[model samples]
Target chain A: MHKIMFVLLCLLSGCAAQHNNIKLANQLQQEPPEKILSILSEKEPDQSDFAQYYLNLGYLQLLSGEFELSIDSLLKAKNEMLSLQATSISENVAAGTVNETFRRYSGYPTDRVMVHNMLALSYLFNNGIDDARVEMLQADVEMKKLAQSDSLNGQLASTHLLSAIIYELLDERSNAFISYQLAEKILKERNISLPRGLKLGLLRMSDKMGNDTQYQYYSKQYPVLSKLKQVRQKKHQVFGLYFDGVVSNKVQQSLAVPSFNGKQIVRVSMPAYTSVQHRDQHNQINDNEQKINSEVVENVDKLVREDLDKEYPSILLLTTTRAIAKYQLVKEAQDKDPILGILANLATIFSEVADLRSWNMLPATIQFSYLETDADHIVVSTNHQGDSVVELAALKQHVILSTGLSDKVFHYEQ
Target chain B: MKIQSSFWLAIVASVILSACSTSVERLDAQQQIDLSGAWNDTDSQLVAREMIEDSLSRAWISKFVKSEGKDPAVIVGRVKNLSHEHINTNTFIANMERELINSGEVQFVASSANRQEIRDERADQDLNASEATRKEMGQEYGADFMMQGQINTIIDVDGSTQVRFYQVNLELISIKDNRKVWIGEKKIKKLVKNSKLRG
Candidate 1:
């Protein structure tokens, strides 16, 4: 019995090579994106954890201005996610016997949606407009499927806004209008205010499509529609996206209760989110004629917290069941042999670690701004990263993507 | 007894290693192998063949030939991929070009990128090649029609099962008159059911 307990302890220890994602998240806040990207590139993640690994690596690659590499990594991550969607009997058994971390990380619904969103942006940065449009269509399908499953799981306003921008760039005004409306609906559903760019896009598309009813309705709500005339007269339309500070990390929370008449401890471990105070950076675009301040389009911090809250009950039940089973095993061993009981208790305590893996490299908030101008170039600035001069092509539309965590700025024009 | 136990362990280890080892088998290029049920070369080649055949059989080709009194010249245009997958439309276009050129019924001209390269080569010939062998510019055939199309897909996924439907639409438009002379379409549907467990 003692030898069996020793072998079990060795197996659990071998499987307990947990990644310190919290430390990596902290490093991402302090270090430059390129340095962190190189570090991530050097580290080989476990085979089952490739989804989470590639998600972080792809986002970092995007921030580091490796658009092609970013697209490749994001695609691999997407494939990994798709393959992991199926229920794995062996993983389930391991999870029940050992810990939840033994199972593969089959990304959350929000992560799935964001993967397509990031892929769209990466394709855009690589000047593949058609590919970007394809990503938008895929994102729409994913969001629809997620909505059918649960209304709130994949209602990401940023994705819709990005889709609207891509559609408008492709000269599909009708689709653009629908995307803007979808973004508005999601924001309204979440009780989040609509960004300025979304409002302007809706009004512009509605007017262009000759939807008098929608135009009139929005005109009454936001008098800013009156400026649509002047905006339409401009020769260029510029859209800017800002990715703010790093998202919060998931930490392990442990609860130990004395059971079996205070002889053994039943330890329940769970993944939790500690409240993190992120810096609120002001972002904007300047075309020398007017200054447009970006507004929050998606609050990833809030979305991640809500996702964890929804999964809390299931995680709690699993942890409790495992804890009870471990306690019973300990009691049975003690009834037979005291040394074996001690060994079993030690193994149980050491193996009861929470699964703390997540796509923690995401931005805290995604912000957006729209500008209509005839200027040849625009200066985009954030309170954290200094100003970047973006030379607009002679095209009618352009998209400028920047992140507060990096100095790089990616531009897509049409 | 110890030798027997060691021999059985070795046999078991060999079996496990063989199971885990990678194996490769060469197969014919035309053989259809469906894995993951996404778009593949087989779909591209088969779609191109069927669509080009349908286009060639239409009345537009004979009408253009009879009116012009010669084989009508054609050029390939952009084939946009609007599907969810990152499909290389280049291969599909190449397949179509090969079929149209090999059919010998219509004249296929260089595409825009190829036209530029040929023009550059001709200019270089003027600079370096012998006078008789030098190719002249401004004498290239101008295509009467341009072929363009887009690939679109509709995917429905439930749990581990997915139904993917792809639609490809191609059009041949008169370069001078801006009239659509020929329209072609091809579709493919696949159902994929993933295993619920991994070993």
Candidate 2:
């Protein structure tokens, strides 16, 4: 009877904590940019939410066109992320024996990779091409390092794509082709069809290099390429457009896995975006705030799902082991004493709280398009609403947009 | 009580472990240490010493001194960095400058970046100081030869192993006749084996 009572108490407490956390997140989402920045600044280093707060704050500042401030905040976030990733044996033991929630919130691999991407974008947004180039190179180097450690991720394609664009703008067509080839291979291996813009880029590069066979290969792969001819030194070039939206939050999912006796139910909290197919949804974009031809390019949500699927086996094994061990401990206690049994069950439930921590401010979907016009200035809009206006002084420009409430715009010219 | 004590013990252990940090030991500046196998002070120092020794021993130094009956004035030009890494080319240039000046075989002039500042100070001195101490403009020594260089790095990485090759090539060219006086090159190769776990 006491064990039953203890279980009830534990469940109530866990539920309350979870509810409060959700409330905090929702509050943060609704808060103003200045308010978010101030809150993040006020947070102490010892606070559990310090790292997450900075990530949110950095992203907020990034969207507000405060690139310098964002760089500072993002660097802090990077330091925190690094420390969290360096998990000691003691932290591991605590998580296993006491409570998984006791461990520091090391962000998901995707979250860490996005931090580098955002930092690079932040520099790019400020028109610091050299610094942006450095950041992108660093991002590629980091992904390579992660690959060496057998860590599979989804951001490699995006990073390579960004590098290719930067190289193209800098008039390094050969380098751009190399990055584009890498991106194409990664996407192909992941079974994702190439984006129209990427195919066009490959087609243009092959044509420029005078590789007739390679140009023919891409031309066949993308039917749209045959309709659009490659134009290198035109008076106006079609610039690429990328739209970003908020990534989905985490939710708990209960899975039944085979165990020692029968099957045990375990709760695994994962990014809710991973379950939803975002490719079907199209974001409406206006060039210079006017309706124009646009199409969906890349959905990061699907890539994230593919990465999670690759790690599902390990997640299942570890979660099943934890569940079985807890069940056995509870059963042993019940055999010893009824009160002790209740306490053990209570401890297990409270300790088994899923690791729901992630970089929630990331975009759920990333869409791309190519706009060809003679206008030197264009106002970008999403969903029939004007977001931000950009000036294109060069022949080629790369535009980035965060279609969230911030409605951020960053453009690069060459 | 037993369970409560065990829980507290675990918490205490975790706190102590989290607080622990790696200890560091200081070493001699000249001692060579190859961590990460990237460029380091030892490599920089080695290249500096060798390049300086080779440059001064060239026939141009003797020929110029014999013809002009004075040490040839030299200026350091822009040292282009065409490598993958963001190396401080200025540091390498400073090393070369120090060695060339110390050898007393050649006179040194300010770099283009420094010449503007030096001239501005001289102008300021002319306005603010006594005439005797006021340095006159256009009295500066013109360089007989300019030393310029480029640093290049090539890296090949496979799995947990990587090989980095760095080549630094410097040229001493006669400003008057547009003739190449001396060319010096130094190469370094490092085979770095990073652990799979750490990479």
Candidate 3:
């Protein structure tokens, strides 16, 4: 009888499962950005949702061309993350009694990196290049923190590349070269192969700085670096678009753990985000025969998966312990009285909700493209669809056009 | 036992309520309080004091006083902010102007924008005010020297550590000979601790 009860209790406590946000994710996919923003903005900064709400609302605002509002929301999300500390007894109790989902929304590391990246993009779109540079610098700081503490191997290549582009815009070649080198090093460390555009940038910059040795080194390293064409004399520009697909949704997993007696079962639910296929479409523009292919520059999904993988062990242990304790308590109540046992069992069953919360709006992948164009008017397409024909009158001479879900262009000369 | 538990809950509620109540206390304005690690009034005042002291100690002021037999007519020029942070250079500029004017060692003239406003008022006086008090526009005192400056910053960050270095450079140029007479520079470095948690 005791063996049967133990089996029943173990079966009652389920393994961790994902909290499903497929409905919300579907809304994000189908609804217009403005509508989504309006709906999400209503619940922003709510105590229950806290960090994730701001994260989603801010990104939605970014997609809707409200750069300032997006920064505001992202900053709020950042503040929430900063205010959270190591788990306290209150949090532990809350996780046990209510659910882990009800616990404080201390954000994931990747979420923070994305916040800074989005803020930089916001500043860049609003013609605040200097502010954009600062935001990118802050992102680099955050990345370094994660790398040092979490033993993450790579840097945020996208943010660093953006910083390099900003430096290039300001005509600060040395800073740009250093940023590119950091991006290259981090990407290599993380086992991500160097993209042709980045290698081309490194090669051209070193050559211009008269670093013949460095230029020769990269040329030999990339071998294809020699074959890569450069349009140096005429002023040309490249547009980069980064698209992040829908991130994995969280789902609820119910496990039944056998109790101390044969007749009883304890059911537990935990939330998780399962990895899925990432569909990324790149955008590129061509002027004459010089067209730069769009590359998948950053994979945000992989970073998120790595974070989850690191935390899974601890999370599982915590869930299992909580389940066991609750099951034992119910068993003790049953030994006392039938009514008390029934009440305890009912309470556990009803409150066994999985913490199914995440920043559901995050894209799984980040894609980028480079175009060499001198035209004052250029039509760039992403996902084989032309979103907009960007006017370059404001960005003549040298231009850097960047886009995420929406597109932005910057044109400046020193 | 139930009554005792109720009493404890009531006490806890009151404590929480008291904690939530807002309270405000005023502090001295001159006190240096670094909150966001951004440029603050203390920085502005410190730069103003240092730059004024350095500028007055330079040979330009005494040389002008010796050569022309009067205090040099000085005017504030453009103070450009080339730093990554959005700093209002005017805050410190006004502070320095106050220090220079109070020193009484330099005859401070109106900057071009201020002069324009003065000219506009003088023009108004020409039409509306008494003839004896009507001020002439072109007869206004021309500055012998102009002070201009630029604010530049360099930031280095690693993990949770950030070091921000700021350099403010001011130059007093002779309008007649276009010779730079006094160059005053103030540098500030701050080691700021950043929150390692990102989101």
For model 2 the local lDDT of residue A116 reads: 70
TM-score of chain B of each: 0.93, 0.87, 0.88
Model 3, span A1-414: residue lDDT tens: 354355434323422212223466656655555676776566425364578878888887777778888888888887777566344567777576545754677777877777878777766777767777767766766676677644663357877787777777766787788888887877887788777778877886777677889888888887765655443544455646556456776667788766757546788776666556666666665554555556766777687766666667767776777787777877888899877787777666666776666677876666655555556666655653355565556453343443444444333322
- The local lDDT score (0 to 100) that residue B124 gets in candidate 2 is 95
lDDT of 2 by residue, A1-414 (tens): 565567657545644544454454455445544555565556443344556656777877786778989988887887677556544566555545444444555555665666776777787777766556656665665566567334346456777777787777766788778888988877776667777677777887887777788888888887666566644343445454454555555666654343454323233332233355443333443454344434444455555565556656655665666666777887788789877866776566655655455566555555555555557766666552345666767655555454544455565555
Q: In model 3, which regions exceed 4 Å deviation?
A: A1-22, A85-89, A96-98, A221-232, A260-264, A384-387, A394-414, B1-14, B35-39, B67-94, B107-199
Per-residue CA lDDT of model 1 for A93-117, tens digit only, reads: 7777668887888888889899999
Cα lDDT of candidate 1 equals 0.86
C-alpha local distance difference test of each model = 0.86, 0.67, 0.71
DockQ, per model, reads: 0.64, 0.17, 0.25
Docking class of 3: acceptable
Candidate 2: what lDDT?
Answer: 0.67
TM-score, cand. 2 vs. native: 0.76
What clash count goes with each model? 0, 3, 33
Per TM-score, the best of the predicted structures is 1
Give the deviation of candidate 2 from the true structure as CA RMSD.
Answer: 6.0
